[model samples]
Structure formats: C-alpha cells, structure tokens
Target: MGALDYVLAGVAAVFLGPEMFSLFGLPVSLALAMVVLGFLTGILVGATPGLGGPMAMAISLPILISLFGYSADALLPVMGFLIGVMKGATVGGAVPAILFNTPGTADAFMTTLDGYPMTQRGQARKALKVAHVSSAAGDTFSDIVLIVCAPFLAIMIERFLDLPEKTALLLLSLSFIATVVGGSAGKGLIATGLGLLAAFVGTGEDFYPRLSFGTEALSQGFGPAAVFLGVLIVGELFRGIEDLWREKARSGQVTQYDLSGDQSLGWADLRRLAPHIGRSALIGTAIGALPGIGSSLAATLGYTVAKARHKPGAGDPKMGEGAPEGVAATEAANSAVSGANLIPVLSLGIPGNVAAVFLILAAESIGGFTPGPSVFRFTETAVNPELVIAFGLFTMMMLANLMNWTVGGVFMRSLGFLVRVPRQLLLPVVLLLTLTSIYVETPRFEVILFTLGFGVLGYLMRRVGMSPLPFVIAYILGGRLEETARQAFAATGADPFFLFNRPVALALMVLALLVIVWSVRPKGEAS
Candidate 1:
C-alpha cells in the first residue's frame, strides 16, 4: 500500500471504531480491553497517594514485553494501556483531594484549594463531576491537537534539518529540558549529566564497554527499560513503602466523609465552566508541548488565570471557597497535559513527562518503531509504519477519552468506598510486580542488582529534591544525540568545528547558551 493509503486507512480505522478487527494477528478488541483495564487501574492507583502513571507504565512495560514479546504488533495494546493510565490517573487524582483534602498526586495539589472546600460544603459529587467533565474535555482537546501537529512537525524537521542542525537541536533540547524541569536548574543538569554518563557506558564504538570497570556483566550496558523502571518505579516504591511503614502505626483508619446533599450541577453551571475548561485546556497544551515543565505548573497557572478573570454570578462563590469553575480549571489543565505530553515524544522522541518516557521505552523495546523525524518520512514507494501506529495510539487515546466521559463521574463518586485500600497493602504488590517484571525482561540477578542500585540513586535524587525527569530524558536521548553529533562530524570531515559554518546549527548553539545563561541568572538581578 502507498503511504497516503496507509494514512487514510489508519484514519478510517479510527473513525470506524473497529472493535473486532485484527492486524498482524492482534485484535483491536484486545487493545480496547487494555484501555479499559489500564484506565480502571490508573484510577485505583492515582486515587492512592505514592502511585501514579509512571509506576503503572514502569510495571506494565515489561509485563507487556513478556506477554507480547518484541514485535510491531505490541504497539497498539501497549500504547492503549499506557494512554488509559495517563488519562485515568490525571482524572482520578481529584477524588482524594476533594473527599479527604489530601491530593492524590502532586499536580492535583491545587485542585484541593477548591475541591476540598466543595466537599466540606457537601458538594463532593458536584466537584467530582466537574473534574470528570473538564478532564475529559481537556484531554480530548490536547489529543486532537497532538494528532494534527506532531506528524506535520516531524515532516517539517525531516525536510529542513541536516545532520548538524539536528544534532544542535538535540543539544538545545537537552539544555532546555534540564533547566526548565525539577526543583533546581543546577540539580536538573547534574541529574541529566548522570543519565548521559550512564547511557554512554558500555554501548559505544570508541569504548565497547565504556565505564564498565572490568566487570564481565558490565560488558553489556543496562537496558533503558531497567534503568527507567528502576529509577522511577522501584525507587518510588521503596520510598512509599518506607513512608507507609513509618505511618502505619500512627494512621489508624482513613476518615470517611459523608456524601450528603446539593451534589447536582445544573446546565447553567456547565455553561459557566465550559469557557474555563477550554481556556485551561489550551494553556495546558502549550505547557505540555515544552519538555520538563509539568502539569503542576499548568494547573496553577490555569487556576490563577481563572481566578483573575472570574466574575462569578450572584449566587456563586469565589475560587478557593468551593467554586465549581475552580474544579474545571484545575482538572482541565492537568488532564490536558496527559495528551500534549506526547507531542514532543512523537515528533522529537523527547518525552515531555514521566508517562511519555515509558511510551518511548515500549516503542523502542518492541522494535521497528523508532520515534523521530525519520518516523514521519513519507515517500511514494514505502509506507511509514510508525505513522500508522501513531494513529492507532490516537485511536486508543480517543477510546480512553470516551471511557472517561462515559463512566468517569460514576467512578469518581463511587471511589469513596473503593479507595479504602491502604498503601501498606498496595506497596508489597507493586514491589513484587517490579521485581517480576524486570526479571521477566532480563533473567540475570545482576540486572536486578544494577536496577536496585539505580533505584537507590533515584531515591537519593528525590531526597535532595532533584527531579529524575531530566535524568531519564537524557538517558533516553543520549545515544541518539551521540549518533547525530557523530554523523554531523563525519559529514564535515574537512573541519572539526563545522557547526560554526552551519547557520542553523550556529543559531541553535547561540540559543542554547542564551537559555543556560538566563536559567542561571539571579531572579532579582537586573539584566
């Protein structure tokens, strides 16, 4: 089939909403089932503190590998599950915040400002419904934007960028991501440097076993899957377990809130919140497109803007005092990040957030689907399989959105009783899952040890308030960055410093330096 034919076929499949169709011996129904399963699991996890989308993706990626093996067929179901988790987690986070005044995730902290107050006023159902609506709308909006833009962006890069420009752009991305994310710019860079160093070890031509330190086991570098899961999931599990153990004795029973009275939101309320949802969705899409800047900032900025612009009706209260629009603004903003986070991942192979990192990991591990400009290289002779898979992911995302829209309200409202599962109970299961998942991928005990070591490092990074986002990102991009730089260098065998003569590469270098300088500059210092 032609490339255009494949594109059109993928689009038709999406709109047709095929349930029983199978491709490459894999059924779309299975993918849909995974979407449902992952969404529910995400809701469960996200409603529980210390569990989020990364944990879900980390645990599931290897299991998916074990189930499906390394094949192109694995993409749809794996991506479906991951997308479901991302959306579900973002929406589910609002439940605990409103019901217990404890945010289910970091991004939902701001949601507590209004959500908890609404619960106190016996509007728990109202608050949850608002969260559901806005979250669905925001996610759908961001996803549509991603589907429209990512392929075009990739094609543009493929058309315009030479090796030197691509290499310089990657370097610029690394610098930008490092500085923009995490608690401290310096710490972010340090983490990124650690990742680059780790990734460079044992896997290059110059040194077949670079930094292997004479160990036979180190002859083969660590898999990106192990490193990512170990640092993000295993380490996080350990911390959560420690916290759970310490608090288990002090924490008796979770205080249950009464779900009584005035829970119904009128059509007028929806009308009032629609504009805020749309606006917050746009804000979040923009923020999420940028690497490293997370949903927490998006939610905060969304709520702040809504507050500044809010002129509530006579009966309606101001934000932070239980305004339903507050719920819409915060939830819409955070949830929108789920879909838009994939924008960078699809176009540049740079994951914008924790969930996207694993999506890249899954694609890489499954093989044949490398995300970058090359993925979107369209020609009359050959079909771009990745492009079609991108559409499949889009279809999965839409399925998840549909699920969220149809059942999200009921699920959130019912979660009051369902979320009684304690961290103490869940932590052990997650630990087991982590070990089993990693062992499935690599049967070696040493790999487990290496993973644990990375886990420990990740724990320490978290302890020091350093974000691991930059670390994982750099690790994932390190090989590609190196490859591109070498290609650029070889292309300019005449002069080692050839980027100086390349206008695009030079412009990117200048921009990167400016960004670093601006990032390092004192906030109070005059320019």
Candidate 2:
C-alpha cells in the first residue's frame, strides 16, 4: 500500500476502533490518547534505572485491560505505548551506563565498557548524545523493517506451516537462541534448560500444579509480570542500593556531565557509522525473527563481528575506549532486534522474546485476538485492514524515535543534576515509585514481599556469574513447552516413537540433542 493510503487507514482505525474515552460528555479518541500516554509512560519507565521495557509492558497490560475492556481501539494504542517504551528504554539504558558505570539493562552493558570511561574523561555529554542518536537511528530503521516485511512473512507462514512442522520450527528457533546467546554452546543449553524449568514452576493447563510447593497462591501459575519485574527491576534496585552504601562509605564524589557542548550529530559521524549500522541492523533483524533469541544476543554478536572486522589501529585509541562506533554497532543491533522480534509474533503466533510474549498476551486481553497467522485473516473481517494496525504501530514508533533523539540528550543532562541529589533522597523515590507500580498491579502486599525475595535471589545469581537470561527465558516458555508436549503425545496416542516418526519433528529432536552435546563439548572443539 502507498504511504498516504496506510496513513489514512491508520487514522481511521484510531478513530473507529473499540475504545472508551469521554471528556466533558463528549466521546474522546482513546487511540490518540493512548499513543500520547504510551510515549510519556515510556519516557518515565525508560529514564528510571531499574524499570525496563518488558516490566513496563507487564505493568501496563492489566491497567489497559481494565480501562479499555478488550477493544481493538484500546489494543492498538496500548501496543503503540509499548512500542514507545521499548524504543525509549533501549536508549535510556545508556544514561546510567554513561554516568555511573551502571548498566540500566543487559543490552546496555556494552555501553558501560566505553561510556563510563568517557564519563571519567569528562566527555559524558558527548558520549550520551552519541548513544542517543545512534540508538534512535538503529531503532527507526528496524521499525521500517517491521512495516515492510512482517505481513509478507505472515502470509507465507499461514500458507505453509503444519502442526508438526511448526513444532519442529519452534525447537530449531529455541536451539538457535540458546547457542547464539550462551557465550558457548554448553552454557547456552544449560541456560535454555534452566529457563524451561523455571517456566514450569507454577501450574499447567490440566489443572495440575507442577511446582507450587503446596502454596495456594503458587497453584495459580506464577505471574509472568511478577517474575519479570522481580528478577530485572527489583533485583537491579537492590544492587543500586548496595552500590549507594559503598559510595557512602568511600565518600565518592558524584560525577556530573557538562551539556554546554553541542550534542547534535554531524554528518561526518553518521557517515562513519553508516556501514556498522547497516550490518548490525541486518544481523538484529534476522536474529529477532527467530523465537527464543533476543536483542541482547543480537547486540553481543554485532559487537563481536564489528570488533573482528576492525582494521589494524583502526581501533587506535582503543575500541572499547569511548568509541562511538562501538556504541553504534551495539545499539543498532539491539534496537533492530526489537522490531524483528515482532515478526514471529505478528506472523506466526510465536513469541521471539519475553517482551513479545507479553505483547501477545496484551493483544489477546485487549483485542480478543489470539496472536498468530490467523490474526491477519480476522483483521480483514473483525476490524480494519491488518495493515492499518501495522502502519499505526510503525507511525507510533517513528514518533517515539523523534522524541528519543530530540529529548534524550536533555534527559541525560537532567540526570546529571540528580548526581547532586543525595542517595537518601534518590533511593526513597526509586523505592516508592517501584512499590507503587507493583502494588497497583496486584493490590497484594505479599507481592511486594515476593518482589523483595526475588530481588535477593537475582542478586545472588548475578554474583555467582550464572546468567539469568536462561532462567527468564525458561520461565517465559515453560507453559508452552508443557502444552506442546501434551499435544504431541495426544496426537500419538502416548506413543514414545511418534516424535521420531515425523521427519520434521525427528530432525528438531535430533538438533536439540546435538545442541546439548555440542554446547557441553570443550570450548576449542568445533560444533
């Protein structure tokens, strides 16, 4: 469809879709309001140290559900808000990494390697601006990919995939995610298996409680939002607090950035980063389309590849030493993965990451739409053209990107002001906001207790050098794995060899076993 056509369609969807908004006894446009609210919310969540995009989505889902009540009008705006947060968070993570040597998200860890050093060298503002621009460019390009490619892929998957083949495809996707993410094959398999186990902890569809430990609350499948926020957001809060205590003991001076210098990107910088941006974007998009893989993996792989291709002394001044290219490569790849991750969800009904899975849930709760190939079919009848939603989402992303680029530098500069504020003031604010958001979601004081408990668990896990990604992934995928296993068995009448009989399924099973073996092998051994 033409650009103008897409725009008009999106405008119509925003106005006509199902959402309840009333102002002064007149009907208000909820989709437009959601778009605006989502952007602001994203900025708030992204600017916070512990809260990331996935946690934001988890917290927002139920609120949107209660407010909008499962209308297409309601769903699109919420999705738009999520997209804003995802994009904003991707850039926002760099702020803490640059100023305090603390990575706000896993994807921003690489930023710390260079960013913190630059801060020590008194170039914090420049580094922060570079990060913002590069991240925005990468994210904007990825959204473009989502606009162009997702629909075509959806059509193809709808035409070809059978149940057994689809199952095999999922296995392949998971294995690939594990291998690419684990640092080594063995680590990856271990992480993936661990994640699967964590996912199995609460309850299954057969009304059977698997690992509830006899607790009534535990019997009702573990809330994904709780685990996600606990492990990521609350866990980081504890870490930040501990760091505060150390800084207090040492009487460390809080370093602040001077933003008086120009923060705008020049054409020369863009030209230098162009190739790396392209390469990382391609890598991220491909990785994101696969289930189980995520932006972290894409960022790491992109950085590694960029480092390997560097010419002698091309990294002179050091590659990990405040080089904008490093930030560009990592940010571009990770941001691109955000868009690509949606591909599998929108097209094939499979989630590519924890965030996408939550998005699927949100879509279901708000739109009464099951996320899969069939969504496109239903869009043609039950709602406006499917393409309209896609276009609207892309437009929202573009708006979010513009906001990130223009306001991100200002936001980072303002954070420098926070350095002057005492930790006593900052910590309480952070704690209060977190508690309030969590409480609003569940209304249970026990949830706060659980969050604190998980925070300790998360901190301990980090200290041991064990990757939490595996656990999180397993926790997210556990229910689906169990359901699929049950379905496969039912189809085979409990025949153990049924999986082996299907060529595609057998191939996937073999691949999964091989991945385990290969990952377990010595580091020097070839897969």
Candidate 3:
C-alpha cells in the first residue's frame, strides 16, 4: 500500500472501527468512546489530591484488559483510553494547584507557585484559563513533533543499527536513565539493579525458573499488574496514609476563593502568552524525546526560564507572585512532555515516563503489537498494521487535544471542590479500590501480599530519596536487553569481545560510561 493509503487506513481504523453503539445514525467507534470516557475520568482523578495519570492508568489497565480480552482488536480502545487519560490529566492537575495550592503531582507544584497566588488575588478563573490554553497549545505542538519525528527516527535506527549496536543502545539508555532519574547516580543504579533483579526472577531460557526458589508462584514470576500498581499506586497510597495519620489533627477545611474579575482568555492574552508557551514547548519536547527524564524537570526548567525572562513594570505582579505567565510556562512545558515522551517508546521501544510505561505494558499484554523501529515499516506488498495502529493512536491524541481546547477548561474549573476532599478520607478509598481491582484480575490471594510487600519497598525507597522510576523501567526492559545481548553474541559466532569488534557498539558503551561518570561527579566539581 502507499503512504496515503496507510494514513487513510489508520484514520478509518479509529473513526470507523468497532462500534460502542450508533449515535443518532452515526457509528461511534469504541476507541473514540473510550477516549472520551478516559479523558473525563482522567480529569476527575487529576483534579483530586494524591492522584494523577499514572495512578489512574494503573488502576484501570487490569479492568480494561479483563473486559476486552487479549486480542489485536483490543489495542486501539485500550491504548486510546490511556492516551486520553494522559492528556486530560495534564490539564486537570492544575485545578487544585491553582485553587487551593495543593499539587497532585510534583510537576503541578510548579504550577501552584504562581497559581495559588492568583487564587489569593481573586483571579483563580483567569489562572485556570491560562493553564488550559498553554497546556493545550504545548501538547498540540509536541504531538506534531511526535507524528513527524518518530517514523523517521525509527527508520534510521532500523536501517543503520545491528544487534550489537542495538544492545549497546539499550545499555546507553539504561545508563542514562539510571544517572538522570533520581537524587544520586549511585541510588539510581541501585534502583535499576533491583528492577533488573526482579524482572529476571522467573525469566530466561533456563530449564527451571532462575530465581524461583522452587515455589510455583515464584516460577511464574511477578505479574506486570502487581509490580506496576504496587510500586506506582499502592506505594504512593502507603505514603499518603502515613501523611494522613501524622496530620490527622490538622483542620480539613480548604480556603475557598470567589471567581471574579477579567477571567476571560482573549486573543490579546493568547498573543501575550504565546512566546512563553512556545519556548517552554520547545524545552519540554526536547526533554521528552529522551528516555527516562520526566515532565517534572521540564516544568521546573520552564518555570525557571520564564521567571528569568519575566520583567514586571511598575504596579504589575512579578513572576511567581500571581503572574499568569508563570502558570502558562509551567503548564505548557509539563503538558508538552506528555506527547513527546512517546517518541522514544514508538521509535526505540523505550518508555520515557510512567504514562508511556503503561502504554508499553498495554501493547505487551495485548500481544499483537510491539513498539519499535519495525512497527513503522512501509511495504508496497502488504499493509503495515502497526503503522496503521500508530496513526490511529495519533488520531486519538489529536481527538483528546480537541477536547482539551473545547471543553477541558470548563471541566477543570468545575473541579475546584475536589480540593476540599480530605486526603485522610480519600487515600483509604483509593487504596481499597486499587487492592480490589488487583485481586479481581489475579484472583490469587498471594499476589495481593506480594503487591503490598512491593508497595512497602517502594515507600522505603521513596523515603530514602531513591526514585522508583529507574526500577520500573529497568524491570520492563531487562528481558529485552538480555534477549538482544544473546542475539548479538550468537550472531558474532560466540565472540566474547563482540561489542568491541563493532566500532559503533564500542563507542556507545564508552559514551554510556562517560554518562555515568559525569552523573556521579560532585555538582561543584562538574562544569
């Protein structure tokens, strides 16, 4: 098929595929319906304290899989829902931060800096509008980059990279991720090692499970649902519960702000904010294209740069002191990361953030799709279903963006009351819901225990300032790394020094070493 044909096929797949039901003589594709549903759900969760996209994704994945089964047909709807959640959550997370100074995630904390001050000044609605506009604009820009760049990058990698080179590339990715993710390179490496260890427990070409210790449950290893939800969701729940217990005596009431004044985001306002949004969008997109560096850093950098550039005239508010540009800069940069983060996942099969990780998990679980260079292959003789799916996914993202531009602001503004929901009351309910969902899927009591164990471990790791991101990424990619290394070794006829024999592979490995060295160096000593 031709390129145009492939594009058309993908568009058709999303708009004309399986129907949830007819909507007034028009067919509403299940994927489209799921996107809408997930978008709304995402906003709800993101507006609430102590919940965000990853948490929502983790809780919903098992249920979606159970409902859809493991078929190629399930891919679009399941992934579409996830994509919606990602976009909606990006927009929705600013609500509480702007209204009540409570950030649902680390990135949103940057939004809260200026956003809450706007609330104090009775311009809360104006701040929300700024956030919504900047976020949607940044996201739209990032998606455009993803659509244009991922295929070309994948094609280049496919054409140029051999197995040993691929193996080295994976090593470089891991090294970079380990170095950049957490507080210290050493701790990140430790987290990565633990992840690799956990991933290899029951996996390999061995006759018996490698680390099973003769237990049947161990032989099967850990389920993805258990490990992912445990570390990402349940672990956070543990932390929240502990916080709630410690702060139980504190007042639960939130200061309510009246929506008043010039809250409209007009054309002149858009033009004024466009420069900040554009700069942050570029910054965020660049950061997102790399594996493992997440949106929080992007938000921080965006806010810092905007603050530096912002010059307040007499009688005007300074940046971070109720300036709308602060909310715009932070929101745009962080939201932009969501779309561009998919670049690594689509092109290299490497997830860049937690949301991308779940998307990878969904594709892996469904069995028909595998994300990587080959997925973008173009052939005249046969249709590339993966390419079609890629375009379909892109369509869903654009659809979500459309929703964001049209109605997301209204939805987000309405969620101001969510700030009043006490964390003490909310955390346990979320905990119960997460545990129940996991149990329903696994149907084994032991998996729950294992999940709680991992959750405890996650909580401990967080307390020590060790990020769980490296661990999760390492766990997902470990098997693939081993498989690629094995392939490289065999292809080189058992050559022990095969990597060194290939200049590209050798260079990549050296680069990986340098990255670790650079990362481990003292901040004062480094350039």
Ordered list by lDDT, greatest first: 3, 1, 2
Candidate 3 per-residue C-alpha lDDT over 3-25 given as tens digits, one digit per residue, 9 for 90 to 100: 78888888899999899999899
Instruction: Extract clashing residue pairs from model 3.
Output: none
For each candidate, give its TM-score against the true structure: 0.94, 0.79, 0.98
- lDDT of all predictions, in order shown? 0.83, 0.68, 0.90
lDDT of 2 by residue, 61-112 (tens): 7667666666556667778767766776777777777788767677888877
Instruction: List, residue by residue over 1-527, the lDDT tens digit for candidate 1.
Output: 67567667555544444354676876556677788888988887778766777788788877877776776666677777888888888888888888887786789998999998888887888899998899889999999999888888888888888989988888899899888887567997899999999898888886457888877888788888678988888778787777777776786467655677777778988998999999999999999999889899999999999999899788877999988888899999998888888888888888889888888888888887887777776666666677777777777788888899898668766776545667788878987888788888889888888888888888888888888888999999999999988888888884677666888889998998888888888787421
| All candidates: CA RMSD (Å) | 3.0, 4.7, 1.4
User: Which segments of candidate 3 are over 4 A away from where they belong?
Assistant: 525-527
Report lDDT (Cα) of residue 416, candidate 2. Answer: 40
Clashes of each: 0, 6, 0
Q: How accurate is candidate 2 locally (lDDT)?
A: 0.68
